[model samples]
Target: SLIVKAISRLGPVARTGGVRGPHGVRSEGAFLSPLLALLLLLLLNWLHPHPKALKCYKTDSEASNLTLEGCSPDKISCVLHFRIDKSTGARHRGLSNCWNLNDKCGIADCLYTPHSRIEDHGSCCCRTDGCNLMENLRLVTSPPTATTMPSKGGSSQGNRNSTSKSSSNDSGSEGGLFAKGGSDQAASVLLFSLAPVLAICVTVVLGFFLYTRHRERRKSRSESVGLASYPVDNHPFPVGHLSSHIRLKERLATGKFGCVYIGEDAETDQRVAVKVFPPQERGSWLVEQELYSLPEMSHPNILCFIGADQCGQGPDLRLWLVTEYHPLGSAHDYLAGHTVSWIQLLDLAESLSRGLAFLHESSSEKPAIAHRDIKSRNVLIRSDLSCCIADLGLAKKFFQGESIGDVHPQVGTRRYMSPEVLEGAMSFYKDSFLRVDVYSLGLVLWEMLTRCTDAYGAEGVPAYRLPFEAETGSSNPSLSQMQAAVVIERRRPEFPAECQSHQGLSYLRETICCCWDHVPEARLTAACVAERCKALRRLPVSVAAEEARRRQQEEQLADQQAPAVDLQLPQAAVINEASAAASAEELRPLREAEDAV
Candidate 1:
C-alpha cells in the first residue's frame, strides 16, 4: 500500500483535493487503478488465448497446383505428413492438411518443426496461419510414416502446457511489479518453510509414477500374444495394432449389424472373419465384446474370437469383431445348396448343441449366457460339416445372485421365439431364459432335419423351409399368424412318416418335440440335447437292433437324472425386477413390433 501511494504521487497525482502539476494539469488517483488493470490484461493474454483460423497449403498431386486451404472449424493446426519405406528407403509425403489439436502433432502455436515421431510416422503442426506453406513444409527428422497419428503427442502437449502454467503462476502470484523487495523476501521465507513438504510430495509422486510404469511394462509383455489382455472398453481395441496387422479383403455377407469381410493377419497370413457393425449398432458390438471377453468362452464348437476394433470416425465409424473364417458360409446357405446325409445331420446337430450348451452352461466363475436369437442363419458350418454358433448380438448373461440388467424382452427373431417368449409370459430367471434358447434350438434342429435327404427321402424330401413356414404356408408369418398356428393350434414342424423308419431320425424327431414343447419347463436343456445327439449318432441307419435298444435306454436315463437335473421348473417364476411377466393379452398390442424383431 505505501509503495503504491509513493509511486502514484511520484508519477502524476490527481485527487479531489490534490495540487496541480507543473503544466497545471491535474491527474486523478483513479488512473492508478487503470494502470494496474492494464498489467492484468497483459498477463491474462499471456495465460489464456483463443485460437484463430489457420491457413495451410494443400498440394494437389494430380493437378500440380497449390491452393491455400483453411483449417477446419474443429481443427486447430496445419500438418505435413510423411512416410518412408524401410526396404527401399523411399520417402512418401502426404499433402499438407488441417489437423486437430489432440492429433499426433505434439507442438502447435509455433513455427513448423518436426515434433512427434512415432514408429515410422512423423509430422509437425503449426497453429500460425500461412505457416504450413509448401516451401515451409519439409522433413527435418521424420522417419517415413506420417499423418500425425496419435501416440505420445497428447502427453507432449500436457508437458508443454504444464510448463507454461508453472511459469505464469510463479510470475503472476508474487507482487514483483509493484513491491519487489517485500515480494522477494516473502517468497524466500515461504520457500524455506514449505521445502521439506514439497520435497516429500515430489518423492512420493515420482515413486508412484515409476511403480506404475513398471507394472504396465510387465502387463504389456504378458499380453503381447493373444487377446487375453484386451478389455471391453467402448473405444476401439489396440487402435494401431489391428489396422497394421489385418488386411481386409472383399465383403463376405451383410446383416442387421453391418458386413462380414474376409481378412488375413499380416504376420501369420491366416484367414480371419471380420464382422462389422455400423455406428448405430455400437451397443451390440460392445455386448458381443463383453461376452467374448469372458473367461473360457472359447470352445471348438463356438466361433473363435480374435479381437474387436473400430473402423474410421464420424459418419464412417464402424465396429469390427474378428474371428476365425469359415469359407462354407452359414448352415442356411449350405443346406440350400446341397442336401445333407443322416451322418452330416448328426454332426451338425451334435456340434451345434455342444456350442449352445457351452454358452448356456457356466464355466469357471463366469455366469451363463443365453443366445436369444438361435437360427440356421446364425450357425456356420465348417469343412467337416460340424457347426459353430455365431452372432451373439442379442445374447444375455445370468449371474448367480446378482440383479440382472435390462434386456429388450422383444428382441430376437420371431420365427425362433419360444411359446413363452411369444406370449411374453417368460420370466427373467436363469433357467427360464435358458429354456427360451432351447426352444429356438429345437426349431433350428427341425429345419436342419427337413433338409436331410435321408430322413424324408420317401416323400421326396421337401424344400428348405423355416420351422412354422411350412405349417403356416408363409415364409414370414405375422405374430398373430404364428400365435394362431403354433400357440393356438399347438402345431410344430411336421415330420414325414418316412422319417420314423430311420432309427436315428426317429429319435431326433422325438428330441425336437422335447425341445420345442408347449411347456417351457418341460423343454430339453442344451446339455441334454447334446447328450442325446451323441447317443443317437452311435446308432446309424445300419446299426444293430441291440445298439438301437441301448440308445433308447440311454435317452430314457438322460431325462430321469439321479443327481441334479438340467430342468429346474419354477412355477410362475417372476424374476424380473419386481415386475410380473407380460401376459399374452398385454403383448397383443405389440404384435407388429414383435414381428419386426
Candidate 2:
C-alpha cells in the first residue's frame, strides 16, 4: 500500500515530464522503478524492533503497586503467590510479579500441585496485564484440587508440539508475541505510518533553531561598532552531580536573591563556597555566570567561579554557583571586633581596587561590567587578609556602541551611594556608573581605615563603624536620610583629625575623600586608587610626617615675618594657618617616631 501511494504521488510529476516510448508506453516507468526500490529500502530502515517486554504490577504486601518495566518477553503470565502463615494459618498478602515460565507451565491454565512448602506451588497464574491485583487474593488463598487441574493429554500435547500450528488455533492462547518472525510485518506498518509526523516535528525544530541563530547574527552585525561582539556562554553545568558530590556543611550568609553555604567536595574533601539562589533569582545567577565566564576575569582579588547547577525543582529549585572558599569570610566580619595595621589596610585597599578596576575593564570577549553593589559585606578576604570583590548580583554590563540613556539610579548601600545616585540625578553613561562603584570603594576604604591601628595615634583604632554611622546613628539608614546626608548636606564619613599623624594614613584619607567627592567628575578612577595605595606602601610615612610638620612651622613663621594684608583674604589665610597649626600639633608623635627612626 505504501509503495502504491508513493507511486501514485510521483505519477503526476513524472507524467508532466513524461516521454512516450517506441510502442506507446511511457518511459516514466523506468524512473519509477528505481524510486520504488529506494522507497522499499527506506521502509526497511524505518522498521525497528519494538520493545516487547510486558509491564506488570509488583508488590510484597506493600501499599505501593510498583509497575515493573522491561520484564522478559517470554514471561507472559502475571503471578500472585501467597502463603498461609505457618503458625497463624492466616493468609498473608501475596507477592505479585511477572511470572517465570517453565516447561511444566500450562498452555493456558496450569496447576502445579495442591500444596508445596518451598516453590509456592499453590500460587495463581494468569496471562493478562496486572492480573495479580489484590482483588484476586482469593485465587491464591484457595488452591485448586488435583482433579480440577488440566492434565497434559495426548491431544493437547500433540497440538502444542505441532510445527505448523498457529497461536490462534488454541482457544486458550495467551496472545503473546514469541519471536521477530511473528511481529515484523506489524512493526514495519506501524513505524511507516508514524514516520512522517516524527520527521516533520524534527525538521520544524531544527529549522526554527537555525533561523533564530541567523537572525541573531544579522542583528549583531548591524549593531557592530568596530569592536567584537560580546561572547555569551551556553552555561551548561553538572546539575545531576551537584547534590550528589558537594555536601553543604553550614550556611554562610543570606540576602535578597539567596543564601550562601559552605560546601565540601565529597571526592576531594576541599572546602567550597556555594551560593544558592531561588528560581526567581535566575537573572542574578546568569549575571554571575557571565561575569566569571569573561576572559581575564579570573584575578587574585576576585571570587573564583567553579561551576553552577540547578538543584531540586519547582518550589524548591535552587540555582547554585560553586566557588573557591575562604575562611576569613567577608571584610565586615573580618574587621569586626579587631583592628588592622596600616600595611594591612593598604593590602586590602590595593587588592580590592585592582579587582574593581578589572571589573570595569572592557575586553574582546566581555563588555565593561560594573559591580553596582559595593560594600564591606560584599568584599571577601583570603587567608592573607587581602580583599577580593564578590557578589555580582546587581552588576550591569556596558556593551560598546550602545546608548545608556536613563538608569535606575537609586542602588547599592544607602551610606555608600554617591551624591548623584542618592539624588537620583545620575547620568546613564559608562564612566558615570563606574564612578558610583569608586564612590562605594571610598566608603568601604573609610570603613576599613576606621579600624586602622596607627591612624588615631594613642587612642587606638575605634570600634568598627559603617560609613556615616556617626551622623545618621543607624547601621541601616533610610534612603531619604542618606539623600539628605550625602546630597543636600554634602556630608561624608568623618575621620578623627589625629589620623593626620601618619603620612600614609593622611594619604589614604585624602584618597578616600577624593573617591566620595560631591562632584562625580572629581572622583578618582579605581585604577588610580589602586596606584595610590601602592605608592602609600612605598613612601616613608614617618619621615614624610616629619617633613610635613617642619614645612608647616616654616610656613607659619614665614607668614608671621613677611608682610600680610596685601589681599582681603587675610581671614581665610589666618583660618588656614590655624588649621595647619592643629595638623602640626597632631603630627608631633609622628615626628618623634621619625626622630626615633
Candidate 3:
C-alpha cells in the first residue's frame, strides 16, 4: 500500500520527465520497476511466519484473576516480581517480558510509583519462556528458589533430566547474587547506625563554640560592673556600661567612623573627649581601644585614655571611647585662628615628634606601632600649647619579628600621603612604614610653620593651608591629584625664605625637608626629628648670649683703635689728677696712724 502511494505521488513527475532510450523509444517501466520490487518485499514479509515469543501472565498490580498474554516478537524472556509495603502491610505482584534472554534474575529493591518512597520491595527476573508462570512466584521471604520447567520442543523425560541440572546451576548463581545484596544491605545499615554519632559530634562542637562566646561576653560584663563600682585606675579600662558616670556634652567633630563629643565624668567631674562610634564602626573602635590599652602607653605627648563602653542594642548600639579632653581642640583648628610664636612652634613640633617616637618604640609588653594616618587633624593641642597624637584607628602594631607588610594598603588622608605611598610602591618593612609616618609628620610640620609668626617675618603668618593645597587648589584633593603633585611632579610644601633668616627656623626647615624626602630610607626617624626640635628650643637662649659677647668684643676693639693724644692734657684732666693725689695722701696718713695704734 505504501509503494502504491509513492507511485501515485510521483505520477505527474514521471509523465513530465519521461525517460527516453538512445533510439527515441519512450520507456516508462524503468521508474516503475523500483516501486514494484519494494511492494513484493513488503508482501513477502507479511506472508512469512515470525519466530515464537515468550507467553507470560503480566500485570503491574496484584490481580484476582490473571490471563496469559503473548510477549512482543522482540521479547524472548519473562519476569515476575512482588513487593510488600512495610508501613501498610499491602502486597503487589507484577509479571512482564524482557527483550534479552540473559535478563538478570534476583530479589532486590524496586521503584514503582513516581515520587513515592520505595517500600519493602522485592523483584525477580528470569530468562526462560513462561518462567513467570511457575509456582516459584509465591511470596517466600527468603531468596527465591530457582526452578526449571521443560522446553516445548523436548521429550518429557529428557526435559525433566535437563531441568534438574539447570535448576542446580541456577541455585548456586542465585546464592552468589543474594550474597552481594546482603553486603549492600549491611553497608546501608551501617550508614544509618552512624548518623546519630555524627549528629552528636556536630552538636557538641557548635555548643562548645556558643559556650565559649557566652563566657567571654559574661567576663566582659563582669569587668564593666567592676569598673562602674570602683574608680578607674591604672588597670585596663572596661569596654561596657558608660552612661552611668559619663555624661556626653556638645559634639566636637564628626568623621567617617563616628562623632567626637565633649563629655564629663560624673563622679570626678573631669572633662573628657567622648568618641561615639556606630555599630558598623565596632572594628575601628576595638582597634583604637587596643592601641590605648597597651602597657605604659600613657605619655604626656599621647592622648590619655580613660575608659570605653557600649550602650543600647542592635542598630541603635553605640560604642563610646572616653579620653582626656583638651579645650584647645586639634592642632588644625588652633592654627586656623592663631599664629604660634617661634618658641610655641618648637614646643608643638617637639611634643608631636615625641608622641610619634613613643608610639614607634617597642617594650616587653607592648609592640611598636605605626600611626598610618598622621595629620594635623589627628594631633590635639593641649591648653599648655603642647600637642599629643590621637586617633589611632589606622595604626598598625608590630610584634617582635613581625613584618609590617601585613597592614592594609594605602590608608590615610590623600593630601599628606608620602611619595612611595602616593605611587603605591611602598616597601613592607618596619622602617618603610615608619618613614610613611615621618613624611606625613613633615607635612604637619609645614602646616605649623606656615602659621608661625616668626617664620614669615613682619608680614606675619600666612593663612593656614594644608600641605599641597596651593598646587591642588582643593583642601581635599583626589588621590590622582596628590600622586601627580607629590610623585610625578615631585612637589612639596613651600618653605618661605624669611624662615631661613632665623637659625632655629632654618634648622627646622632642614628637618622637615629630610622627613619628607622622596626616598623612604632617607627620611629622618621620629626620634631624630624630636631631638632636632629640642635643639631648636635651646637655640634662642644660646644665640642671644653669643650676640651679647660679640657686641662687648666689638666695643673693646673700637676703643683700642682710637688715636692717642700725648703731653697735652686738658685742664679738667689735670684737676682730676691733683684731687686724686690729695685724696690718696690723706688715705695713706690714716693707714699709717691705724698701723701705729
Candidate 4:
C-alpha cells in the first residue's frame, strides 16, 4: 500500500516538469533535481508489480484477484498456477476442476452469479451464446510458448524510454503555450487511430496462445490421469508367448480384445490363432466365455476356440484363448485388402448362416446362444472363402433353467440393434430374445450387400440426426441425410442396384428386410433365415471343389494348407454332438407334424 501511494504521488511530477518554490530562487533548481530523482525511482517501482514478477512461484494461492478496471497495456493478462493434491477425494478433485474453470465456465455472456457446486462446473457458461463462443475460442487459438518475463536490463531500458517520451511530450506541449491545445489534440488523434489495429493484433495473438495452452493442458491432464490411475501390471506380455498361445504366426487381426496372431504350437506343431485379452478387464473374462459366450456350441461355419490359458490376474492374467487360424482372415479385412467376386460373397453368406443356425438351435446345455452383436467386422473367412462368426461378448444364452422368457433385457450393437431393442422392448417376450440377434444378422447381411455404400448417401447429414433416427421413428429419412441422422430418426438402409440385378440376390435382400422388420414377429429366426440364405445361392465353383482337386490342379501352387490344428474341440464338440442330435429330434417331430398338416 505504501509503495502504491508513493508511485501515484510521483506520477504527475514525472510527467510534468516544473521549477521549485520561487521565494528561494537560488535553491529552487536544487529542489527540482531532488523531486525529479524521487519521481524516477517511484516510476520504476510502479511499472514492475511484485505479483507478476514472481513467476517462479510454484503455487498461486496468495495471488490477488484480476483487476481489469485500471489495467495498463503491459499487464493485460494475469496467470496463476495451481496443483491438485491427490489426498483430496474424487469429489474434491471434481471441485478443483470447477475452480480452475476447466469446464469452460465464466466466459462470454456469463451471468455474474457465483457457482458453488462441482456439478455446476459450466454454470457460468450456461448461456447459449457463452457456450458457442467458448467453442469458437477453442477453435481459434494456438497456445503461449513462454511464461517468463524479459531480462531486467531490457525491461528497465524500455521503462526509461517510456518515461522519457511521456515527459518530453508533456513539456513540449506546456512550454509552447500558443500551440499546446492543438498539439495535444493531434497526439490524441494519432494514438486513437493506431489503437484499434494494435488491439486486433494482440487479441489474435493472445487468443491463439490461449487455445494452444488449453489443448496442451488437456493433453497433459489426460496423460497424468492415465499414469496415475492405470495400475502398473508387473507382467506386460512379450510378443513371443502371446503369439504362441493364440497360434498367431503373423497378425491376422488386431482388435479391442487383443491382437490375433497367426501362430503354431511348438509341441503339437499345430497351427492355431490366439486371442489374448488385455490385462485390464481380466476379472469378468471367464464369465464372458463360459456363461455369456461358449457354453452353447458350434457348426463348421463358426470359428472354433480350442484351448484357453485362463490365467487370472498375474503375468498370465491376460486371458489367452486359441482358435483355428484362418489364412484368409476376416471377410471385412479381405474386402479391404482385395475385391471379392459375387461367388465369394455367396460363400460368405452361406457360411455365416450355417454358424448362426448352430447358435440358434435349442439343444445346447444353455439355451441357444444369441450372437446379439453381428456386423461385417465380426465375420471371419477361411482359405476357401468360407466365413464364420467371431467375438461373442454381446452374446447371451436363453434356454437352460432360465427360459428366453426370463432373458435379461439389453440391446446389442448400436448400428445393428433390433427395432425391439432400440424401442427398449427387448427381453419382454420369450420369442423376442432370439429375434434381436436375428435382426442384427439381417443388418450384417445388408452391410455385406452394400459394402461400397458410403455410411450415408451423399446428403450432408449433421451428426445429431443419425442416433435419433435409429432410436425412434419407423419411417426412413432421405438417403443423403441418413448417415448424419442418428438418434430417433435413423433411416432404413437399402439394397444396392447391383444386388437387385442378380436373381440370387432378390431372396437374400427380401430375407434381410424381413429379419430387420420393425415388428419382432415379422423377423425370421436365425435358423430359418440361415436356411433361406443357403437356398438362394450355391457355393462358388472354386470353393465347392474338394481340397484334393485343388491340390492336383495347383501342384506348382502351394497346396491348401491343413486347417489350424490347435482348434481343441473336445469340450465344444462333445457338447455340440449331443445338441445336434437333440436338435434333429426336436425338428423331426416338428417336421412330421408339418408333413401331416
Q: What is the lDDT of residue 287 in candidate 4?
A: 31
| Reference-based TM-score, model 2 | 0.53
lDDT of 4: 0.48
lDDT of each: 0.66, 0.68, 0.68, 0.48
**RMSD, each candidate, Å?**
31.5, 26.5, 26.1, 29.5
Please provide, for model 2 over 1-597, each residue's C-alpha lDDT reduced to its tens digit, 9 standing for 90 to 100.
644443343345433535679998867555445444444434444553343555566764462455655456445556555555666656544556664332223333422344453432245555545555545544333553222222122253452334124333432433332222123234444555565664665556556766887988976754341112223233122433566789899999999889999998887788889999988888788778667767767788899777776679789887788877899999999999678876788899999999999889898866898899999999999999888989998888888998774557787777788888887888878999999999999989988888876666444567778888887888889988988888888888788775665556776888899998888899999988887777666553543455455545545555763345344257545655665565556556544543442
Please provide the root mean square deviation of candidate 4 (C-alpha atoms, Å).
Answer: 29.5
Of candidates 4 and 1, the better by TM-score = 1
Candidate 2: 10-residue stretch with minimal lDDT: 145-154
Residue pairs clashing, model 2: none
| Per-residue lDDT over 2-42 for candidate 4, one digit per residue giving the tens place of the 0 to 100 score | 33343353546544445545674444344344345443553
lDDT score for residue 47 of model 4: 44
Give the candidates in order of TM-score, highest first: 3, 2, 1, 4
lDDT of 1 by residue, 1-597 (tens): 442443343333222334467787654333344434334333433443334556876666442455787765445567655555667745455556665443223343322334443445444556666555534544445453222333223465664454334334454432233222333233333443444554566556556766887998976764342434455333333533575678889899888877899988777787889898888887788778778878767788888777876668899877788887899999889887778877788899989999999998875567799899999889999988999999989899887777776776766887888777787787878888889899999988887888877664324576777778877888888898887887788888888674665556776888899999999889888988887777665445443232334344445555776553334222112221111122222324333332342
What ranges in model 1 sit over 4 Å off? 1-240, 266-268, 541-597
**Poorest 10 consecutive residues of model 1 by lDDT?**
571-580
In TM-score terms, which candidate is top?
3
How many pairs collide in each candidate, listed in order?
7, 0, 0, 38
Query: Scored by Cα lDDT, where does model 2 land?
Result: 0.68
TM-score computed on alpha carbons, candidate 3: 0.54
Question: Model 4 residue 384 lDDT?
Answer: 83
